[model samples]
Target: MTNTTQTGFALDEADRETFRRQGFLTFKVLEEEEMTRAWRTERLALMDRSNAVYTEEWAVSGNTNISNYDRHLDNDFLADLITDRRITDRVASVLGPDVLCWRTEFFPKYPGDEGTDWHQADTFANASGKPQILWPQNSDFGGTLTVWTAFTEATVDNGCLQFIPGSYTSMNYDETKVMEYRPDGINRNRKEGGVRRGFFGYDYRELQIDPDFVPDESQAVPIVLRPGEAVMFWSTLMHASYPHSGKTEDMRLGFAGRYVPTSVHVYPDTDVVEEYGGKVSLDRYGAVVVSGENRYDHNRIATRTTTGHPFRAH
Candidate 1:
């Protein structure tokens, strides 16, 4: 296993304890120049979607809630981002040494865009109606670790993330309950605080176990991030975002790298991903092992990039 202190991203006993209780942790991932380089790299990557794993005009906006999934397989910058010890080391601390980054996504919010609705995911079956990750039967945890990095600045006024601390234990929404997708549902609902938010055209409220249940905004905390900063949280945590008030012309962009232990099964019994009103084949899909050994053969492992570059977890 890659030593944590050597990479300066390892979690101490205190750090691990904090994460265990809070269900999330925040830190800076890239230096200033590194942040600049990542921004430029992602910008150039978006210009050409030919090499992207998922191909479909499947997004509500030009940024957030889109179909561009898993660029780490084809893009070197993203491949490096997934395996960066600044991320992997800490993730390994929580998920153990044997870890795999199974998914990555880009969330962009333009001025006047609606905030992402409050939600939590266990198997990530909320949108696809299929379990994307299944934990081992012996394990107690069932969620993936999501590391969300800010490519551009994210503020509450510009749609920053919000989380309800210690709310990762019990689930309010059932992924088994299917919600109808409506493209025109954007910016339709005005919650208690006049927050314009929706879950990619579907009302996350529909999956709530209680039809009349509502999230407590009083307990919500804003996670404002500067360029290159990141926050890691359980996928099962109660989380949401703020609406982009459109006070600024600059758009907010967030890149999320999702990690799990090697024993977890990714995209179980699936060949193609259908979501956001678009479909994409899984022929080129492979999980990138970020640390230790991948003893489980159920998942298709991507040890190297499409360009034949071996992935190093340092």
Candidate 2:
């Protein structure tokens, strides 16, 4: 890991502590003008084609199928944003400089696409048969730092993200049962409270409402970000997005990067691999290292290793 003193966006001790507890953090106005210029140039080239994918609602506005320097196609900008000196330094401050950008995803909420269900962060990783995240240690290493950068203004009308502020510490819901909430209901299981927050392909409607689920709506502020503003949060935090209520021409566009320590193991099961199809794996579903605080090659997958203890319990 390179010394971050020159990276203009180093994180202080307090910032690192916040990330350790919160599971996520964000750095605003860190991208340089030259970087942003290259991003716009490439995107415009992609848009020149008459059949650009952005025409759809709820899809990544510009390019849907980008080449995989990493899964989700680490476009020049995406890669820069993930390993961004600002972001990486902050990550290193908490998880140590020996870090890697594990995953990056572009979440584009179209004008008509329904918002995803309320859920925690661990379930999002597709790391084989075991749960996406291995708790305790998984929760440690500062959990996973998700950098949410806005490509367009994300207002309440355009489906901004909502979260249960202090919910990161809760025991994440069971993945097997959560899968039952998918649209197909393939993995549904009995829940003690009957509040089945959807997963896999499940829909939110199937969830049994937690009558005591009195979410602090007041604390759940709607994040209205400018084209370049962003927020980061812990993976375990309970969060959801609102549906788009903006004009037909408007849609919400943002990008996210998930980072994990290098010591985690990954699962190599094909079936599980299919579940997290778009992800870049170190081995099968083995852990992936995506971004770090230095000039590293893009989409560099580590050779499989049985280093860390496997995290199980689906």
Task: List the global CA lDDT of all models.
Answer: 0.83, 0.50
lDDT of model 2 at position 206: 31
TM-scores of the models, in the order given? 0.92, 0.65
Off by over 4 Å in 1: 1-8, 56-66, 306-314
Each candidate's number of clashing pairs is 1, 21
lDDT of 2 by residue, 119-210 (tens): 65454432222444332353433346576778777877777777766678764444444333133332243222222222334543333245
Please, what are the lDDT tens digits per residue for candidate 1 over residues 147-190? 99998888999999999999999999999999888878787665
Candidate 2 deviant stretches above 4 angstroms: 1-8, 14-24, 29-39, 44-74, 123-143, 181-201, 204-214, 267-272, 276-314
State candidate 2's TM-score. Answer: 0.65
Best by lDDT: 1
* RMSD score of candidate 1 (Å): 3.4
Best of the candidates, TM-score: 1
What's every prediction's RMSD, in angstroms? 3.4, 9.3
